[model samples]
Target: MAMIVQARAADAGAIASLAEEIWREHYTLLLGEDQVTYMLDTIQSEDVIRQAIESGTVYWLVKEDGELIGYVAYDLRESELFLSKYYLKHSFRGRGIGRYLFDELKQVAIENRLPAIELTVNRENTRSIEAYRALGFHVLREHVGDIGGGYVMDDYVMQYVIS
Candidate 1:
């Protein structure tokens, strides 16, 4: 295991690459290639990343020996923490990076004195649901989020009570 670093604005490209890989490897199967591409192109745009940093949404890149392998992007809303994006390089999956990332994010939520952490995951993604359940998050409600056009994020809003 190598020490990981939470990257800053200069690390945007590395995190963007990780985001693209995550979109392709994770969402492409469920959402299809075009949806994945649209998401990557739009959400991972340089301008969008710059805006994220400017907006104070903390983006962290996991680096080992100076090589980027994963990243997490999240934001705080009052007393709640929202996890928007969390992923590892496709090749790095199953090596405990996802678990570590989640743990770290949970800590972030706790450290900020947030009452709970909330997230939305596609209802069809049982793997992610199971993972969240293992980490003590419970489904709160089912809602469909429109990403754009006919693409919608059919998700279960899950929350983890930290305190």
Candidate 2:
């Protein structure tokens, strides 16, 4: 059975390590090795993760049998929860872990009185787009943002309205 634990400052290194592993395994095919390397170094570095946590981003680590497998991070926006990162090890995909994490986030939305949960997913990530759709998310819009280093994120803004 998988369990979710709130991440702490002490878990920054583990989170960064997990991000490196997952991003390399999954994003290399979609974003290319160069972009993946840049992203991992800039966004998923331990210092960046710790700064994000300190800035009110909530991270939850998923562990099974005492081994970390995945993590989800979100921030409470004005009236919605903005899901910034949701990743699972490639080996752990195709199971119900993603849904489990989504369910947990829904509870968080309710508790915080957020009306919706929103996230931006790479438009090319067909599997994740389908999974989000399956979980009642709809595409709100398309976006492309330059993240420096000559890389741009082409993504679909997806939202799940909480009723």
Model 2 TM-score relative to the real fold: 0.97
What is the TM-score (0 to 1) of candidate 1? 0.90
Clash list (residue pairs), candidate 2: none
lDDT of 1 by residue, 4-74 (tens): 57556776776777678677888888888998888787888666876797789888878766777777778
Worst 10 residues of 2 by lDDT: 89-98
Residue-wise lDDT of candidate 2 within 40-105, one digit each (tens)? Answer: 988999999999988879999999999999999999989899999999998888798999899999
**Candidate 1 backbone overlaps, count:** 0
Q: Note each model's CA RMSD in angstroms.
A: 1.7, 0.8
Off by over 4 Å in 2: none
Per-model TM-score, in order, reads 0.90, 0.97
What's the residue-level lDDT of 140 in candidate 2?
A: 97
Which lDDT values do the candidates have, in the order given? 0.80, 0.94
Candidate 1 C-alpha error for residue 29, in Å = 1.2
Q: How well does candidate 1 score on lDDT at residue 118? A: 89
